[model samples]
Target: MTSHADQPNVARTLTGQSGGEIPRDDWSAGRGRLFLLLVAPSVLLLVLLNAYPVFYAALQSVRNGTLISPGEFVGLSNFAKVLQSPDFWHSVRFTAIFTVSGVAGSWLIGMALALLLRAGVYGGGTVKVLLLLPWVVPIVVSSMAWNWLVATPDSPMPTLARMLGFETPLFLADPLLAAITVCVFKVWCSFPFMMLIMSAALSGIDRSVYEAASIDGATGWQRLRYITLPLTARTTYISWILMTIFCVNDFPTIYLLTAGGPIDATTSLIVLAYRLVFQNFQTGPGVAIALMMTAAMVVVSLILFRQIRKSGGPA
Candidate 1:
């Protein structure tokens, strides 16, 4: 007699497959196969379009020429030069300032707007719709609009400043001011995305949680502190990370606004890379800078991910 451990269920024998077992109760197996089948095309496209170009840029960073003209294999020379070059360092510094400022500004303003709008006060929907307008506008159109608005002599902000008795500050002319200008514009243009994300996350939160807190003698601030924020922290962290990356990579607005500026003052890494690749035709250094930017962003993202995970949450 066969051991019970070796015997197949009686249901298997009815199918006329001797000693065969039914499939394990792993629900994900079939779904996983189907998911891979569905995602294969997208994965292939991503590899071809994004991954391939990134790898190609990394490869090109080592050599010293354009696609049309072959040059010497300089190994790490391009990266070293990029790191040490004054212009590249300036760009890196500007990029860091812009990224940090823009991310903080966007998150702060967006979170405020999200919280206010979530209170369902008067005109909340209208305010949300208006806030979304910036995000819906094309970047080029928005860039041009900002350029016309601020860079022009007769723009609103300057006019208002003059009217208020303060000397009209040339927003785009000064390097420090230009950086602040870019940060403000970036925040204005980007906050809608954060607001939307925060709104969704806020909506998913259970009202019962707040009610439960209220019944326990929790004040409004107490409810927000203990219950609302912790539950929403993960989404907020993700929003901040995404905004940081976008701020790091933002180009069109700054490019169109200042073209890296009155004296390369406004140039960040992206603009610097553009100047290298297109203006100066230095493909190797350009690719090196791009790779550096990508690596930095990856590191920041990893740090945030680890922190979020350590907070006993999934991000």
Candidate 2:
């Protein structure tokens, strides 16, 4: 007499059933339907919210139009005009500089702060809250405060410069100084975000790994360079991608601080697009610039995403 364990399908055979388990094909089909059902609402929402605007913008980009009217289609002439414009190139240059500075400066400062905090410094919780104030404050309030700090010769920054026997630098007036100020401001506002992300990543690292490395005679710098950085690489890549997007798309920082300024000195692509659409009422060219920026952003995001996958392991 064989036991049931020796014949797992014995009950099904005795009961004249096909099998005790659902068919693989049927199970897969059922799961596929459930997946579709679960995601359908989100997909529909994305189509309505994101896809429609992008489609409308793509349509408007190739046409001569005002905000109120979709004028006749001109077939890439808007793109051509934007490409030929000197102001567009100027904006692109500033945007590149601003994005690079913001990403690098924020990451360096934030990572340093994160490492410092990881060492269990005194009153680190209080310090972290203080650090976050730059990011947590309303952007409008922050912008207003920054303007008061540097906008005039009578402002504190220029006043300090005068006290130091230096010619009062027109931070928002001079092209180069305005660009530097905007980039620095972006880094200041953004570093706290980077700090939070890095802090989380650092906390997830096992302390034992560092203890073992120390046993092997690894110095502090060596542990950081070899162990800490490698362990946090995926997070680093992700943070860089986010910060890059933030810096590239940041309009308010530059606009509020400088209004693209004394002679359009700090106009980023977004600012230029805004000036064209809202200020100049050139909808077609404005949308064209915006679409170009979107394309560039997509390309950059893809590149960084690939790096993230690489850092995380086999895709």
Using lDDT, give the best candidate's number: 2
Q: lDDT for every model?
A: 0.84, 0.91
Clashing pairs in 1: none
TM-score of 1: 0.86
lDDT of 1 by residue, 28-87 (tens): 476689999999999999889988887778788999998577577999999999988999
- Model 2 earns a TM-score of 0.91
Winning model by TM-score: 2
lDDT of 2: 0.91
Task: List RMSD in Å for every model shown.
Answer: 3.9, 3.1
Give the per-residue lDDT of model 2 (tens digit) for 188-275: 9999999999999999999999999999999999999998999899889889888888988898888888889879989999999999
Tell me which residue pairs clash in candidate 2.
Answer: none
At residue 240, candidate 1 shows an lDDT of 78
